[model samples]
Target: MSDDLQKELGVVRDEIDAIDAQLLELLNRRARCAQQVGEIKARHGEAGFIYRPEREAQVLRRIQGLNPGPLSNENVTWLFREVMSTCLSLEQPLSVAFLGPLGSFTGSAATKHFGHAARLLPQSSIDDVFREVEAGHAHYAVVPVENSTEGAVGRSMDLLFSTPLKICGEVVLRIHQNLMTREPSLDRVTKVYSHAQSLAQCHEWLNRNLPNVPRISVGSNSQAAELAMQEAGAAAIAGEAAAERFNVPILVANIEDEPNNTTRFVVLGRFDAGISGRDKTSLIMSAPNRTGSLHNLLLPLAEAGVSMTRLESRPARHTLWEYVFFVDIDGHRDEPKVAKALAELQQQAAYLKVLGSYPAAVY
Candidate 1:
């Protein structure tokens, strides 16, 4: 730590700063070119010029295919995701909404998908998220659809059944549950609080460590952290963001039983991802009650060479033996083959609702 050495180090840091500035300038220049491409498309009267998943995928894959540097596959994917997100924003700023109060996982996922620069709004409930997008208050809304540890988020499914909003995009987020507390000692911990799913994910840890302590379920993990701040004897199971927001110390990090725990969030918006040659269409249909009725309903898709991605049953709400099948299949609604398949499917279904067709998340 001599003065000469410090001066030399400072000079190196200045060079690093200069290199960073140049890199940023190059990025902006590239983004401007993307904006020009968008402008050209706009001048040609192309409808909805911003998003192009196929082209983006091709670009990223080409970059990865040609990459020779130290940057790994994931590094390149992340970098391009940000770069494309920024470029798209230049064409048109994306307005996104998510379940609110800031530090929630849905909020984090929304930010992750659209980037921090996108105009993000927070809604109080899942239905409100749909309403926001439907009412044109926001371009899209990110809502938790399902979790690996806890199955489906029922509220989102229910909203899907009721709302006209289409599923435009999807995001998968890794869930890490942290036990945060204000108490300095585990011995002083009297109670644990967290969201219902977080508690379930960390049930083994809670039972093993604080067997005698009572566990309470709060509205959200962030709320649990806030509760723990007021109650010194309590700890909260939540994400890292919650811990930082509440200024609670993380007692046990990554307490979820499964390390590969991830949640799938769906983006609902006024428009679908459009006819990207590769995509998935989600629909709700009810078949007549018969042994072969379900089989017959799916037969048309099979005949058309369509692949079903997901099929989940939910109660139809009105009658005693009635149910709605939420079907997701690999095809776009606008495609001729898919359109024909759906037309045939209608003959078999008592009720059919084409929820949406959107580009499947490539990851």
Candidate 2:
């Protein structure tokens, strides 16, 4: 390197150091403000709910809107999310549970939404994940509800139908299923492993790359990573987190058949969130078992001028042929239009339960 170049870089380094110091000072000031807010809430005898889903979403969206960036909006949002998370922890660290063996995509979503400061408890099953929060052992739960490529997560949807936990927030994770193994190349891989959903997501890639390799479906992605770590001539289909956590080498990157493969996760909590301007309401309802009853059940949403975003159906338990409908609609449940639609919906439906309304995923 030339002396002139070194001198120029050294000047920039000094400026960066000064900026670092200022950031440290400002971060502490913000943290102190968070603590004061907590104290004030304590004085008022309010229920101490430190994690405000709507408030956090509003802040992230506002930050993204105001970004004048060399850094992309996503990078800026992530940085600010960490800062807010750190500040919130100064008030009270949260406990979040997810289905896992650590390094599962659900675990990543939990951290993405809660930040690393929150204590994350990994459970064996989706039922256990819900139980952890419902029993007050954990503050919240993050569970996958659906995927873009393969559709609904059946177990999660089934649990949501009965669980008392409310949907307080959501996360949308862009899935990048990598081929990871101890071997340097895919040629030596005799077998493949991954969760059923992940295996389905990468089906086309596997057919072209390893036509004869036996693809095994395991309980979770992390478990597949674990098997690959110990088994010879084996590879796992998982994400960066699993590869890193298990120290497996990634032989192929983003092997998902769909380029835009994504998974949607919902945060389960006991209480509901206040309205965020752009919000979504999720609910489960069943129509009367007569012809045209399902259409009648959904007519109120259109009549009230509320947009319906998603509609899914699952077989209702205890009834051989009956099914329940899961619906997502624009606007918070608190909004007048949404409230009116829901009121009308309640009158026409045989059964109805508003899972909860919350801020939509910021991304």
Candidate 3:
């Protein structure tokens, strides 16, 4: 090798080593601060759910805004998330529950919001995920409330209405659906396995490329990937986590009909999240059995100058005639305008429940 080239490489290596040492020391110092926080909280007799969702949201947003790096804001946020997660472990191990077999998008959401340092409890169903947190077996539950491609996840919404758990945070993951199989090409494939939502996301692709192949809906894409890993002439449509977890090789990548497919997942816990500047409050309300009841119910928000972001109707389980309306609004419930809207809404609606008010997804 050229001596000049070796000398140049050595100089860069020396700089890298020095930076690494500095980072290690800073990380340890942050960890010590975190431990001290936990200790101080304990001394004050206020230690509970040591993980703070609102504070974390504020920090992430601030760091992202301040980032002026060669690395993208996403990369910077991810690095800081991991660093914070590691430091939090020095205080207390955060526990999170999610819909699983461990490779589902829900699991990815949980890890994304809570970071990898949290103990993950994989539940078989969304109901199980909620029950785990409600029963105090887990610190928090993460579940997919909606997908951009497939619309609402009916089960999650239903559970959210009934569960005592509150929505404390949210994670938005950009989805990439891959067709993975052991087969060299699609020619030999006989069947495709995926969650129903994934199948719908890739519906056009499947129709064009594998029309004759039977598509089977499963409990999750992770389960689909597992089956594909062991079966002959089989392929699974799943996210990268499932593909990696089940050790399936991707033959075709990002086959979703919509190129910008994304899923929004919510964090559910016993406690509420404080107001972050940018926040969303979810609610379930019912209109009276009158001609203009629906419009009347929403009038409060308009009068208060509060913006309503989403409104969906579900069949009220208690009555045949009444419909339950799930609403998402722009501000936190505690904010003055939002609070005034709710105050007015309380008088008009037959029923009202504030599901949660949490910071909006960072990205």
Question: How many clashes (backbone N, Cα, C below 3 Å) per candidate?
Answer: 0, 0, 0
Ranking by TM-score: 2, 3, 1
Ranking by lDDT: 2, 3, 1
lDDT of candidates 1 onward, in order: 0.81, 0.89, 0.88
**Cα lDDT tens digits for candidate 1, 90-162:** 7888888888858777887887777666888988887788888889888889998775433337778878877
Each candidate's TM vs. the true structure?
0.82, 0.89, 0.88
Q: How close is candidate 3 to the true structure, as a TM-score?
A: 0.88
Write model 3 residue lDDT over 1-363, tens digit each, in one string.
899999999999999999999999998998888888888888898788568788888989999999998989989888888888988987888899998867677778888888879899998887889899999999899988776533347888889878899999989999999999999999999999988988998999999999999999987787899999999999999888888998999999999999879888999989779988999999999987789889999999999998888898988775544788989999999999999999999998888999999999976
Candidate 2: TM-score? 0.89
What stretches of model 2 exceed 4 Å from their correct place?
Answer: 1-6, 147-152, 181-196, 210-236, 242-248, 319-321
Candidate 2 collision pairs: none
Reference-based TM-score, model 1 = 0.82
